[model samples]
Target: MAFGFTKIKSSPIAVDFGSDSIKVLQIVPTNPPQLIAAASVPIPDHARTDTISRMAFVSEALKNLLDTQPFKGKRAILSIPAFQTIVQHMAIPGNAQDNIEFEIGLNLQQRLNINPNRMIIRHFPCINVVKNGSTQQEIICIAAMKDIIMQYLELAAKCKLDVVGMHSEPVCMLKAFEQLQCPQDTSTAQCYIDIGSATTKVVIAHGSEMVFTKAIHAAGEQFNRQLSVKKKVAYCEARQARIAHAHGIDLEASLNNVLAQSQGGSSHVNDISAQAVIPMAKNEKTLGRREGDKDSIEQETIECLIDEVQMCLRHYHSLFPDKQVQKLIFLGGESNHTNVCQQIAQGVRIAAQLGDPFARLARIGLKNPPIGVDLDQPQPGWAVPMGLCMSEANI
Candidate 1:
């Protein structure tokens, strides 16, 4: 067994288990990577919070997707949810004549209050520091709860899938973006912000190697909820409004179009709701601007998001000042929102752009992608699964 960390020989499917949805992908390693197949499915409401419920839902969903989709592979590399993993940076004495595992176990036990015997610990070695003429290796530690690991294993077995290896979400995203596009100057650093439905993942990487990774509770859900509260509307309606606002869709124009259709005795009015027809409410507070502006809703919401990103950036720089981030890259479904992208760039004071993991890959149109997939444009959320497949395919 590879213990879910070692690479396997078979063509491994990349499965990203997220809080709201599951993304699956498989690719063939080529100069320009070939997309084998891809799928995304929403998580059921009953399985949102309970572990066993989630596992059961996911197992069933995986089996159904594989059976129906064009994906080919039995082995898989999974993305460990950021919330389930404990990540930290530590320095261990180098040039020592001692077993490294023993040192790591002792450090974790003393520092993190974690029992090494009950956790599967993995470390990625980073640049070494010279302290008092002694070599000290700086490494990033990732530890997962043993029971959670077992749940994933069981889920894989239930689907009759071989679990080849597992990696953290931040790592997978970094790998996928690096393969797609990265600064040619290895010395320069870049930041990756993956804004999922319920959580946001921040990663600072030098080239393909990550120096820092963190998970924040603020994400698309928070923004939507804020919009709902501020606008005094239902959540589903608020969600539609926020998405439309972010995409710069003129609500008034859309409403006019609908009215024109309705006047022609079309059934468009029946299909459109009052919430979607109305424009976003103004008079909401904004960041770095006067109150009651039309864009205030978006600006104010993104202010909270920017605060979290700044915290992560401060922490990253505190540890590695020399590796200052040169640019910001946004991933995930929320990254498609133009307003979010612009606000993040202005808030971070760094040039920002959306990441395309399929930038260098073969153009596989969105004619028949897996259910819940949006191939009309670049899907930055697929970065995790794509990166996992790249790792398995060794591309």
Candidate 2:
């Protein structure tokens, strides 16, 4: 009998630099991966203008987050921002395996005007294709500008952290789903809809391999803007209202101050107008229409989101005619909306549900989770960072 069995462990952190915030996660590399520390902080507006300033701002944020928690190590894997990267599908001669690198470089120059030398290009094998009456291999190519990668490295160095590996946001997202559900049949396809603050990344994958991907430039923030315009409320207030509506809560009653402010009255109501006071005192329903109006605005916003998602599905089908997306898995911040998830499922006529990465990890025995973290709840926004943590040796 082997008398010595010691549990192997590695502490690796994952930092996701998103458009709105920086999310940091430290995980102990175990079978299920234990959460050592986690923090999310907003990215200041001024820091977003340029790369140098943004890198400095991110470093500051990273220092603050790490300072607030007890993360094990300084080594980290960074999630390359989607805005700074691009994914392309290239068709090349199927038999050109001898000079595949040259073929890939030529295709990049021809299609995207991207010099392979200036960018880090990685390819994932996709299904073979028949185009122009000739057989070709379709490969998904991910490229991130060298400068962008350096920016992240610089940030890590400034934060006194070691950069171990880097991955695109979409690939990290797919990796999270792979741990969540393992498709028994390779032909069964699943689509991941990661609705973030500014963009919605739609990724179609069979098993752990990504087959198709698209980013809807308009997503959660777009809905917030529409709510602000239609509901005549401040952007912050509209964001809250949109989130409540997504949870299937009627926010009309709670939005009294916002409605009052919209009508040229102080939200605090020190000196109430006769019209405003009369409604509450006399039970007039005039202000109640605003409630109905809010509902209508929500419906319109959700419909637009559904339409965009449907178009993405159609595009995926157009390219891969034989593959059908059997399930829809929602992720990112906006996917927390139950109504949004239900509506998209109904609109697309597919089985839809939210992806809970935490719960998936828990099944593998995530130890010492943050004191109050509810593994049952679906946190769509944590997909990327969590997946990044899973990139370590044993997670």
What are the lDDT scores of the predictions, listed in order?
A: 0.71, 0.71
- Per-residue lDDT tens digits for candidate 1, residues 1-395, read 34565533324888888887888887766667777677888776578768789888888899998888877658878888876888777778996426667777788999988899998888787767777988888777888988888888788878888787888888788778665455565688889888887888888888887777777777877776776677676565555555444444454443444445435845332222121111112212211233344366566657778898998889778778877798888888777564566567677888766776866666455335557754445567788887887674321
RMSD of each: 8.1, 8.7
Best by lDDT: 1
Candidate achieving the largest TM-score: 2
The TM-score of candidate 2 is 0.80
> lDDT at 55 for candidate 1?
82
Worst ten-residue run, lDDT, model 2? 272-281
Candidate 1's displacement at residue 324, Å, is 2.9
Alpha-carbon shift of residue 175 in model 2 (angstroms): 1.5
Question: Worst 10-residue stretch by lDDT in candidate 1?
Answer: 272-281
Clashing pairs in 1: 283-292
